[model samples]
Target chain A: MSPAPTRRWWAAALAVTLVGLVAGAGVALSGRALLVVTTTRLPVALAVGGLALGAAVLGVGALRARRAAALAVALAGAEDAGRADERARHRRFLARLDHELKNPVTAIRAAAAGLPPGDDPAAVRAHATLDAQAGRLAHLVADLRKLAELETQPIEQEDVDVAQVVRDAVDDVCAQAAAGGRPAPAVRITLPTVPWPLPHVRGDVDLLYLAVVNLVGNAVKFSPPGTPVEVRGSDEDGAVVVEVADSGPGIPDDEVGVVFDELARGRDARGTPGSGLGLALVRVVAERHGGRATLRSRVGHGTVVRLLLPAGAAR
Target chain B: MRDPAHVLLVDDEQAILDGLAPFLERSGLRVSTAGDGAQALTAHAAQPADILVCDVLMPRLDGRSLVRRLRADGDWTPVVLLTQVGESYERSAALEEGADDYLNKPFDPQELLARVRAVLRRAVPGQPSLAAASTLVSGDLQVDRAARRVLLAGVPVALTPRASLLLDYLMTHPGELLTRERLLSALWGFESMVTTRAVDHRIAEIRRALGDDPAAPRFVETVPHAGYRFCGPVTRGVPTSGPRT
Candidate 1:
């Protein structure tokens, strides 16, 4: 059997007390009245019932408030934990960056210091290896640091020329394409011939360029030497729309949305060098500028990436 | 005229400036510095620099504002931004503000130097003239840079912005190895996540577009552990499609 309800138990006990009190008072106030007991019972019964109802209502309201408070506390704790974890991760990443920067300098210094004139071919190869590794580490660290910084700051905003941004991106990747012996993708800038400062955007110029650099760089990396990467931009929906379309293999449908999360990597794709924070960084930067980054792809066809920033906000 | 490019470097970290300036100067460039945006502007006005190398974040007016202010003045000096963060937002902002180039922090001195040289070369007048062999070709395929057109088999193939750039690079240096890092940085405009397999995807797409077999590629050959290479021969004026291996 269920335990007696606390409310009911209390009500019964209080009713007995009230009845006894009223009966006693009636006996004292009225000397020897025959109907006194009956009269006392009625008043006592009403008092007990009203008190029980008021207590129950108050208890329920308090319980609800307590639960809401607990939830708020839990959420605050989670946010704090997230911030701390991010800090620790950032420190490690920066440490890695420092090590990377020092590696190249160490190598060059060591090689220059160690190698006597007329060193053997093997020694030369060793030096070259050190140099190459140093360069690699440097690049990796730089990329990581960039990813981290983009996550943390307010990018400076200004009136920037979108078309120029495209041209600059191509130029930046040219050396890489040449080094790979991959053909540089063809560029066709189709902005209005009459340029008017190309739309002033409010954002961090360096960060924006890097974001575009990453897109163009990725295109060059994945595309075959002779295939093309199409870059197109226009003012759409009151925002500046920049799209980088590549003939390369497209992202899988399921992985598109999550590609922007921190350290997210695609399934079926592996063995490439990166910290997996690139897209996450891109998303952070885009949102900071009051813009957005999106991706679309078909398995056999290719991938197209769109970055949208509010148009007049560029000023 | 200043023979050496005068550069104003803005960074909150004193050590970064201390280490960078000497290294840059050693590369035969004159370097100046600012701790923040306000200082950067004052210094910039005091002595107009040929180029600017500023960090993305700083106190009292960060690097972005510095670039914008300079551009607003119609100075048009080339600027290369530096950053600790790898986000596209910062990169996009820098580009919009008339920045010529950008480099992520913890970069190689050599890579930074190369970029500096590239930017400065473009800024300086008449360097394009020194590029006597500017027209790059591969297997009778040619690109007329001045006209901004690409031709294959005596016909011009309309290419999108990215394709043209890819072709341009391939034609410029026909037989060298290029790594994925280099290509991604140049094309995508930002260094992407390290785990991305996008490079392979892009290569496949390019091969398909070029009608080349991955098994036996002709114009573009994959150099495992290295990068991609263009393997065709060409004459400047002739327009011929690259051979399928």
Candidate 2:
């Protein structure tokens, strides 16, 4: 029931009141001068009855409205409180898990180093594999905790040059690939400069750098030897958009939806050496900076990932 | 800070101490262990270490506070902080709080050793650390990286973004001959030594912007079909607090 009576109720009450008035008048007409005083008294009685009925209807509606409104507010408040508690618990749990894993990871690495030197080829492979796996595990744990921390952590606000970030990330990726004895993919950069130059992004520099590095690094990872990766930066309606495209095998259609989920790995990424949290971290950092990470792929053609941020949004 | 440097390693995790202490000692250095920051303080008071490689987020006291305490007491010992988080604000804050350098955890032990050695070697009584230097100065030319603007003879000079980055790369590796192939891979992300024309173009642009004649190079020197190098002297310093242009 609402706080106010419906129009139908008001209409019915008006009809009832009018009928009572007419009935009272009819009684007066039917009666003689000797009953005039009784007729007037009877009309007053009908009006008083009408007022009492209207008051009763309004009183019930007001009570029900109060109760319903209070219930809604309580439920909403409880839900918010529950969500906050859950997030806090999740963060603390991840931190503790990271802390606990670091010790064992370090110990495993040490134990791997102390593996006895031997002439068996299998033994040598085991030694290197153990050490590498331990290190990878350590990185995975750190990244898991970092993603959670980035969710609620306060980030810095600085004038960031995306071009500079892209240049640096590309440089680092190429250098790393060369060091690993793999053919580094050639990267072509296209950025807007004619239209008053590309506007500086108001964001955290390190976070932005992380996004570009992940984007370029992933592109390089899946690209074939001697293929070129393209990075295009442009201004869109006062917002900045960076697109990194690669000539690698595009992700399968069925596996595309979950690639950005935390610790998600696509079928095509089976043999890739990654922590499987790069895209997730990039998305989180994008959200934290009032932007978004998007992807489009054609399975056989390639994949294009875009990171868009609105200008002047330094939040 | 001394030969056969003494390293004080502090952490709440015994496994780290157990694993790293022996490795470090095997590398020919003295090591002392502390369970927490308080114990570290007592140990430091008893016998000062030449270098302190400690983890942040320790019990009893934390790494940043320990650094502050040491700095307050006029102890300028080189300190390297290790942490599990990679927050940018916290990274800058750690350096500003007087830490010589900080490394994120899950790092290679070899890398940690390299950092320790590098920090120790560069710990000149009052010079700024590597990460803290936001500006690079070469005779009559100043590049404020934080500001992303360059100055020549105290006057701001306008250069394209690519040229500016090239200048920065050259300035950072001053006097080191950077071949065209190397520059292309480092600056252009090229895989092979494929036609190094792009490198020569950018170098020419930067040279023109800086008013340097190829015959008599003041900033960038050509190596006659080999490569290029920034022959100017370079120094690291803190940037003036702003964008001056």
Candidate 3:
């Protein structure tokens, strides 16, 4: 099907033809002996033998070259596909950024246009709206920056107390809820009791704390008010595991895989106040610390997020 | 008539300081303003406010440092922190530095007012009325801290001192996740080398004494990987004569 293989075929045919002609010429030049051989058809037999030998050598070389060329094309195709995939990911990232930015900018613009030149209450209200939208935009940008940092920054490894980290996360979640005017959801923490020792994990404490906070906060955000969010810690298979479980509407099975993707939100979380970077950040932080973040959920039950970090030696 | 509770609002942003001051004043609290933590300290020294509402990030000094400085000087002025949204780490850090409470920025003025009032009530001396109830009653389980007794179905349960203390703490902070470390530090103090396992032993003992099932816990719920929580709705019960703190 390709030109190189076709050219090789043509060259093999030419070699066979040339070899047969030469053998025939040599037999003819031998005069009466050649004429006797030709009469007995022995000269034709030698010509056929020479053509067969020539075709075999050239055909082998052609086949090898054809195989090599096919391999080269396949390799190039794979490289092209990889490049295309990278490009598509970049495009998607930009599109998501644009989509996130557009909302607050549009709101700010609309509010600004509605602003009147007065110290009236309506003017103050508009100013507040503009300020709030600007804050939203700032928060989105900040989350994006933090996510970028998490991806690129080298993590600081130190022995961290898992129980202490969980406490800090719970405290933060409560504070955030109270700030948002929502009654603080009751967060219950269960630590592995004695016989089961509390395991120290090796990671950046601040980053790990942030990841836990994000998990707990997400659980709280998705759940209805008064539903208890539970955080539990244990060591399993040489890894320190912290699980944050929420009695919220669970993520659908089809949407579970992409929950760790940047800007990916569940259908049930449409009106929720989040930048959709929380889970992605958690996954990044866990992975950077030589650990992993995972989620388990059932639609009607609840969602449980597990953050596992490599267990460090007891300090 | 006593003076209205005074609040000192500190933030680097003039717009925020301006935006919040009037709303707080409208909520019936006397408000003072400071541009940053340093100014807040100076203002507090000049005339102490009933409570301090400070931003976490600001010029001259930050909210955490401000609270730390105030606390170091034995100034236990109930302080509330204002932090950026999603900065939960900051909120906890501020709390560790002795801040009474915190609110995330772009907050509803109403929430701020509520926190201000709540913190004032807690910080004010001789305000035992705002303290948690002395006795906790959940269904058949009754924990009376003043009496140092736990009763199930009106029958007294014999509990060791350690078990009694653990139960009292859990009952006092109903619905709160009390971690093993917290329990250890609270019960055994910082010098105790007792591992979290000891806390579990005490909890088990208390659970047994109370006849609480771990699998389907009625009163003490095990929040897997965190700690124990009193899951039942707690109510104030009439105190009986017993040991008093």
Candidate 4:
């Protein structure tokens, strides 16, 4: 069906014709002697043998070429599809950004309208209102920026202090936990006591931090107040694995893959407020780190998200 | 206590400061405002403030960063954050950074006031944890926080963590109008933007576990807009008809 295969078919046809001519010429040139020494079956046999051999060699070459071309086309199509998906994801991200931005703008407007301010009840209420709305907007922008950085850049691999990163992440979210009005979810951080001083792996620490933040935050977010969110790290099959597990409603077995799509909230998470980009962002960051994220969950149990980063590209 | 709670409010917008400054002051609290986190930090350090009320979004310093920077310097002040409709992601970041509480935009002034006061109370030396342990008792239903167990008519009822916590909070405040904010803060923390319907969904799960009829309404009474109430006459201790005692 392909052009290369068709060309090969054409070549085979030409070869067959050439062999037929040569065989005919031989028969004619030896006409009298050939007739005397050979029966009619001899000429026919010679012609058939020559043609079949020519066809077989060309056909094999055509088949191989066809297979290779098919593979190339498939890969091309996949890349195209991925590009389209990326574009679509970007659009969704922008839409989310718009929605997130609107609130603060609305608040700022309201706050300003009531200003020039002293200690009026109206002014005080406005101040608090503006503070809260602006806060929401800042978070949205930060997440958006993270997405952009990941898309436009590549991580530089270097010796990263895994233990230090973990400590910083915990410290980062500790205050957030307290501010959210729930007792800080107990964080059980378990890592090798020894500073493994893992091989320098190429990665962007900031991006990885964002990924860590998202995972830890989600663990705390989904869990009930006072529940523990655990962060565990270990070496698995030569890769450094980090896992964040929560004692909240786990993803359904069937929806595990669906949870990593941009703006794709889980079935049970429908009405809950989520960026929907959390898992998607995590997935991207994991892959960028030369690793991937896998989720294991039981319906009534809990969800554990594991990020596997290759230990400094195998020596 | 704590100098009657001096509050430092930070936001890029002046209108909000204009409106909320007076309301907070009238509520027996002194208020200060900064247009951004940098200014806030400066104002906060000029004179020690009891609390930091901050916006997550700003020109230079964001709420999460403000908290992060503050914590980096070993400065711990209670923070209450404000979020928008889809900014649940920020809620976690804000909390992770050490913010004390968060309220969504278009929030009722009274609700905001309540949240601020609640955060302040918890931040105060002697006040109980914002999510202080409390038991809810309704007819045939008893939720014990200390034991993390529930009973229906003297019978122990099995509940998922979320369900047990939800029922426990409801049962503890029998007659009080438990606002959604309070419930979310008590259960998932203010970082979670749990929908009212989700609350109903969990309540349904609770009722199913209790083997109670929603139409007839035995234990948890659904109070539209205001939150749930424990209407069932409950007695604490021992299982009578719920799960295996």
Candidate 5:
């Protein structure tokens, strides 16, 4: 029923037919010999039968060679198609990068042009606008660099304390607030106080720290002041887990799935400032540590983000 | 009313410092400026400001290191960080480093002023301390830690020692996602033979006492494979008479 076996059967049948024709000629010559015909006819019939047998074998060999050539062509075509797909993906990435960079650059240029040639408050405001736009552009570049590094760099795995990482991330956010001259949001870290020691996870400390910092920082950005942002750590399902919860406006139900996409921001985060690489980086860091990053949020209530990493050997 | 708080603003960029300095000054805060982290430290030493407003990334030192160094030295001056990279990771890192708050770059100046006031209000002297608070209230649920009792809508809810401890912990740390394993380790010592299932059972018991449905949990929401979170707009309440366990 299959095409390949059917073709083979047809080739075998053709060879049989050629053999049959030669045999028929031989039979006819034998009959003539018996009926007093000359011995020359018998020799001619035997020579024809030998030629036919050789031709049938050659035809079968040719059929097999053709099938092998077609198979090789098909395999080559599939490989070529895979390469094309990869190239297309690369092109798409480059195009997205170009588009992301252009927006901020254009804004910066416009702000620069608006700067007046005078010592006035308006000029100062214009300069500030330019500075902010330039900063935005710079941040985009930094995020891209981090993404590239995450993709290409080899992870240095070691025993890392999830609690310590959480503490350091909180510290980083506080420092940013102090440096920026903004009031730091109240961040509450809930660690087991009675337990003398905290559980450790296996991961690159620096990358994990960055990932946690991103989660907490996002909570602060979306939440209102006076409401506390909570960071907590615990062991769950044989893994060391850290969670950041905020009393901020949460992501919509529909948009929750896409928040992990590179450069994806929530629909409610339209006016908020971000490059949208934070969650993406968290996912990358978690996966690299043989873990995962997950989020749950209810609109207007709050959002909770968790980073779960494999538990390391006890120290 | 107390005098307007003195705020020291630190940033690497002259333009940012220049722009933000006048804005704070206009908002009626005594503002000082520093170029980098080292300079911010020196400036803080000479005459300490009520609050520090610093940029996260700078040439001589970063914001996190500066705050850490200050905190390590036992300086408790309230600190805030100004971040261009407004990721949650950076914000949490700042907080861990001893920053009181942070605002993303390109923020409204008025918003920054409001945050400064809010932090100062919380830092005011003789405030009710979270650690010392004996009664914790979230919605209609109340837990009296010292008395070891829980009340839902003014009705007494009997709980086991472990369940009471769990409830107290949850009430004290509202809005925190506490994992079942954490509950197990904390309530029962790290070496306790109890499984995570025990924690689940205890939670179920506590929820039943509070009349919270597991399917649509109001007090303790299950986080699937992760753990549980006490959803709360928690408030501290004055201790009241309750039957002790």
Candidate 6:
């Protein structure tokens, strides 16, 4: 890797060539030179002795280098295998947890859906609570499973139109918000036109879909009903940048740094219904696609979450 | 005047069976339950159910294999697989294996019931399931989806690639009201930022190629303030004889 080692190799090659020439000349000059003079001039015994010593030293050096190289490869392989095993164990755990939870959730949901609307107010409230909580619990399990799968799965790459992804995310957020018994946020999608269109980002469309949905969903969830959730898209320095801006209570300065962390929740997000893993998913998706997700928020003002990704050409 | 539709509900969990069986019965369906895929197969052998609702991850013979086995034996029963995993590959793989449709688990019973009803409505006796059918015929219009070719009145109709894709999606969905957002996502993945006009542009292209009238349309119909739907009845696979020009 270094020039010094290359230079050393060249020098060693020259030394070997010179030694070969000198040995050949000695054999040719044997009949011409006097035997006593030739003996006085560096004896054949000393030359053979030096050559044997050099060969032994070089052999030991080569053997040590080979052993070190093998050891490094083995350590790297073990580390990778250990990581893969850990991922598999995690997947199995999630699968078991999902199965164990899914059956009961389905049962509870069915029971609630089947419950006839009675005149009793308390029973109706209890039914509503049970149904809502069951749905939330199911959502939590799904989120956990997706996060685990994302860690182990290889991401797909295709030319993804950012405009389409943005629209899909907004629609998903609105539908989810409506399902949660809240007014759907009015989303204003802003993208370039006429001069330059939004660039396509080559990545897993589904993963990008997931990432954007989480971003806009989180923004809509934290914001009050009827407030605006604005999405902006543009091409900057050969990368596509999408920003979700929401008029909501912003995170505290101390909590801002950790918003993208796994299972991290800010003080402003305490009462919100979420899995607290959306931002982490966003960050991971962006990083995997050779991009990044960043946030800029002001207390009591608003928050802006930006997902930047390298632009990809036609697939 | 008609008999209640029969549904074969299969799951490994007993509690799931207890919870869903009665609910389905209450929904006016003649629900027969199976403990696992093997049991479902045996039950079907005894008396074939109108439709099968199977859980994908049963211990003895998984849903995919069950569907595969049934399909290999030349059975054309409509099967709807219920999967727990969220992988698109698994769902598509099941579809490719000749399953009619698949719904993710943890879904509402009402949703499952709706999907079952829809699949039943599409099911035709002695006909190949929708998944196995590559050609669709409706009167003079016949499209071979695998060949990506459209023929009207026994004559080839040239269509843009986008129009062809839109037609394929519409033909497959048939009566389903496909919104512009869904169409955009399906066709262009342009779900946001761009207006719904992009879908209209492609729909116009399709209508032009098919010689369909927006008013009293024979093939594609526009639903006011909603979406578009394929109006005519679609028979799965190619007709035995060519359509008369």
Candidate No. with top DockQ: 6
Q: What's each prediction's TM-score?
A: 0.41, 0.59, 0.40, 0.44, 0.38, 0.66
lDDT of 3 by residue, B1-245 (tens): 88888989897766566666766776678889999999999999999898889877688899889988987777777877764321324323433475666454434455467667756754545222111345668898877654567778777888765567677667645666767855654443311111255467668888888788999888889989888887777677776554332
Question: Can you give the lDDT of residue B101 in candidate 2?
Answer: 62
lDDT per residue (tens digit) for residues B1-245 in model 2:
54687899988888778877777776667899998889999998999898899888888899888988887777778888886322445534754566766556655576567667767766766454443456888888888866777887777877755566678767755666778865654443322212455567678878877788989988999998789988887788656553465
Candidate 3, residue B54: how far the Cα is off, in Å: 29
- Root mean square deviation (Cα) for candidate 1: 17.3
Comparing 3 and 5 on TM-score, the stronger one: 3
Cα lDDT over the full model 1: 0.64
Please give the ranking of all candidate structures by lDDT, highest first, separated by commas: 6, 2, 3, 5, 4, 1
DockQ of each: 0.07, 0.12, 0.02, 0.06, 0.02, 0.27
Where is model 4 chain A poorest over a 10-residue stretch in terms of lDDT? Answer: A108-117
Q: Which wins on lDDT, candidate 5 or candidate 6?
A: 6
Identify the superior model by DockQ, candidate 1 or candidate 3.
Answer: 1
Q: What fraction of the true Cα-Cα contacts (under 8 Å, chains A to B) does candidate 5 also have? A: 0.00
Candidate 6 lDDT (Cα, 0 to 1) = 0.76
lDDT of 3 by residue, A1-315 (tens): 256766867798899999999998888887846333345477888898899999988978978888788889988998999977874675467547744453344334333433443688887887777767665664455455456545644455566788888887788778867878989788999998788667888766656776888898888888888888899999888989999999999999999999998788889898886778788878878878878899999998899999988888321
The A-chain TM-scores of all the candidates are 0.57, 0.70, 0.63, 0.66, 0.61, 0.59
lDDT of each: 0.64, 0.75, 0.71, 0.66, 0.70, 0.76
Candidate 2 lDDT, tens digit per residue, A1-315?
232545555688799999999988887898755434445577799998899999898977875677788778888899999978986887788888877776677666655654454789998888778877887786676568667877887776767888887787788788888878988679998887795666778877657777888899999998887888999988889788889999999988887787777778888888987778888878887888899999988887889999998776767
Error of 3 at B24 (Å): 26
lDDT of model 6, residue B83 = 61
Put down candidate 5 lDDT per residue, B1-245, tens digits, no spaces. Answer: 87777999887766666666766776678899898999999998998888888877688888888988987787777776764222334423533565666554434455467667766754534343232356778878887755667888877888865576677656544556667755653443221111255467568879988999978877888888789878766677887786664
- Candidate 3 regions with alpha-carbon error over 4 angstroms: A1-117, A120-122, A178-181, A313-315, B1-245
TM-score of chain A of 3: 0.63
Between candidates 2 and 5, name the one with more favorable lDDT: 2
State which candidate, 1 or 6, has the greater lDDT: 6
Model 6: per-residue lDDT, tens digit, B1-245? Answer: 88888999898877777777777888888989898889999999998998999988899888888888888888878888876322445424644677776555576677678778877888787566655666878888887755656888878887755576678667766887777855764454322323465578668878888889998799999999889998888877664343322
